[model samples]
Target chain A: MASFIDFRNPPGSDRRADNAVRATAEPRWVRRTLIGIVLGFFALFLFLPLAVVFQGALAKGSGVLIQAFTDHDILHSVQMTLVVALIAVPANTAFGIAAAWAVTRYRFTGRALLMALIDLPLWVSPVIGGLIYVLLYGRRGYFGPWLSAHDIRIIFALPGMVMATTFVTFPFVARSLIPLMQAQGVEEEEAALTLGAGGFQILRRITLPKIRWGLFYGVILCNARAMGEFGAVSVVSAKISGKTNTMPLEIERLYNDYLFPQAFAVAAALALLALLTLVLKTLTEFENARQLEASRRVTLETTIEPPSAA
Target chain B: MAHKKHVLPGFGISLGWSVTWVSLLVILPLAALAGKTAAGGWHHFWETVTDPEVVATYRVSFGISLIAALINGIFGFLAAWIFVRYEFPGRRLLEAATDLPFALPTAVAGIALTALYSPNEWIGKWLEPHGIKVAFAPLGVLIAMIFIGFPFVVRAVQPVIADLSADVEEAAACLGASRWQTIRRVILPPLLPAILTGVIMSYGRAVGEYGSIVFISGNIPFQTEITPLMIVQKLEQYDYTGAAALGFTMLAASLVIVLIGNRLQAWGNRFRKHA
Candidate 1:
């Protein structure tokens, strides 16, 4: 996520470079016009929808918005969304760290294949991500009859929803962490081990601090996706009112029922969450840039060794 | 760089966990779908995929998605160029806004887009007078896809554009090339792979997208119906095998797109090296 931003010029050089380009770049009128068009494009496509979410939510006044939020079904959906995130985020974070550690720290056979397998979820559609679960656990599924005999409802239940969300978000933490971890390498941990620190000690005292931001960024992404997951959850949820309906599903139900204000109210809430996620993403990215600059400066001053061969 | 040795202690534990978790959560379920898809034998699979209605759904899904991706590719490039090359008030805010599609829930996007483009809505009402129906039409599918896919293109291309050095452009200018010539000759070639990647990702995402497109498309069978929606309808009817067949088709298509993208990117890299 941090690497998504390309601050090609060092921090100190950006201003001077911007000035240099501004002096000799395209005409002011042309530049202004282009900028206006770009901004307008964003305003229409991005900002306008965002505004509509709120406008529609507030259409019936603040009282309706409150009533919508206070609706029992909507409240249950919110709780369900939180519950899903609470379970999924930590699970994925652990998996991400483990996968990143294994892939980055060791050289082995089929390593490329393992990384590719991790990326499989990224290519799989969210709809299919849900559908696969149905294929595995729905009434007609291979394990369906058995699970039903045992009275364990995996599909059309919370477990099914959690599984679908987990599957859909499986790659976020790992994807974000792998590159950062690969670049980090295992040298620091190796150094700590050489100094007689135990495995857990090195991980806790050295590695955790270094990779905490990446982990947090990945967790945020995972959490956002998990909480907002719709297509996949929709398939397995069976839309059993408050029982299986997540917030997004609730919003969809409301909209489909012509409960426009209620739908937009919930959407506004989700949109706020999205905005918060974006804010966190920006902060993490900025902090990552700062850290990268600091580390580079440190390396230049020492000039004795690089951290990792890669 | 070549892979290096490490002294990590939990390699076995971590690797084992990764394989087990991924296999259980993702691999096994997908394999089950694939297995079920083939359960009816190759002939059944062929007939399902070749069904004319299914075929038309595929065409509509991929066709509109491709167009949307292409639109994103062009506009996204321009947007990336603006973000990377210019300094202006609210630039950071607007640049951040590009990622709204990524963060916003697909359902929210679908509804917002539906409202914005419905004949009774603001933008839709204005366009309605011109016979350009958006909501409940195939055009609505394109707009929904564009709304959802715009970020992939912008995100893919922005870094490359930003990483580009000003010195190269200045050198091109000093060599008596016009700005357009400089961009065409020096800028675009390297950016092509990124653009292609973005387009492929956008296409793949749009193809599989359901939550957002479900509302906007109006789900008129054989007209505005999409593959994912068709699959859901199958699921609703308890047609597990049928749904799996459609889902498997989508999966195969995505895999092929990914493979092609990888090959093209590799080819691009080789060409760069040779040059």
Candidate 2:
């Protein structure tokens, strides 16, 4: 990879002795200044706000924090968020797997278009994500008359919340899985078929195991966004206390009502969820790196030694 | 190529499921936005989108988003450089923390920022005497935009910088080229495309951002209000067509940015292959 940028040096050219000169290096002071600036930026923008959440949450006392948690409205919002995630995450996971399989396995027209469409939600504003649903399902919307005629409610209801969450999180699983599956390729599946394995057997025994870490990574990301989503869900939720509010909306409600401690307490809980997500993400990334390294070593060995020797 | 066959089973089922889900969940709703906008008639759509207050939001949203992306382009590039080229204490932890904005709930971030930057708060108290108001101001909107977009540039440029060889700079030095000259002529040329892609992506994310900006900006129309906020306000008023019109404009702008980013990325790949 580095060789491609080595315009003056041909491939495999020796230049190790020149490394002692440190010609390409910045001065010690320059390096320190650069690092200091970057660190300060992170401290100011990222770390400070994170610290403020916990500080504000505990400003009154731990007692108030506990009280806030036990509040019926806050508890209901937590339950509502859980219910939404329960409906959305699995739905997206299944869709992601199917989309990944379809995209990575087959050669077809519109493959690029399909992948782009899968990613469409990420680019669109969360507001637009909700607004589109409102256009289709609100009381005066496209299907509004039909839905009302049947006495069915979609907007400001559980189904609309789930849809908004699903829309925002739709791409995470498939996006993570596609690159991993494409890299692993069809050779393993072909070999399995040659051994008389059925489709489900191959999927369960081979494909699933191979992509398990990626799948977990994707699912974790999907779950984090599903639970934390604000804009899209807020648009459709109507913010009716105990009925439509999720955790983020609940925080907004508390903050707007001048319940600062309670708002931050709720936010701190969500912050903890975000922290847990980061930890799980880092673990999966570590596992992914190890898996890739092990596979690369296996490939190196197989290429070096004849297959018949095995 | 079109006739290529796959040995894998369930292709049809998988494709069918994916197509059906994408259509129902993603495409159809987006189409509804378009259809609704069209049904309102072009003249009404134009009037809503071009209304003075709505135009003010476009200025605030696009202007601040551009500024935030530019800031990220500079600072994010530096951060990426340090992470890739240097080893330091807590570097790994800091790198992981960069993704906090992406993972943390935006509403949480919004309030957290408000808490920190409000006049009575830690950072804000210091600046308040200097007449710099952050919360409930355009600066607050800018900060929120910057926070959400911080990760894009760093993530984009890190791999490219890592892949860049130190030997090229060494060679430039061997030829008696100055450090700045080598950086300008050799280093930045290859990195330009990645930086552009990152900046554009950040800009796109910032433009559509709603959650974080709502609290910090105070949603004062024609002041700190963003376009997405305008859409939501329109929806709240039951002005469905107006909301749809704004939504359509935003979606079109994002799609164009994405297409351009893709083009730049492809061009970058081609340049690398030739090099």
Best candidate, TM-score: 2
Query: Residues B201-256, candidate 2, lDDT per residue (tens digit)?
Result: 89989999999999999888789889999898888999999999999999999999
**Error of model 2, residue A231, in angstroms:** 0.6
The 10-residue segment of model 1 chain A with minimum total lDDT is A1-10
Native contacts recovered by model 2: 0.78
Clashes of 2: 0
What is the interface RMSD, in angstroms, for predicted model 1? 4.0
Model 1, A283-302: lDDT tens per residue? 99888667656656765655
Itemize residue pairs with steric clashes in candidate 2: none
**Candidate-wise lDDT, in order:** 0.84, 0.90
* Residue A249 displacement (Å), model 1: 0.6
Docking class of 1: medium
TM for every model, in the order presented, reads 0.93, 0.96
Fnat per predicted structure, each in turn: 0.66, 0.78
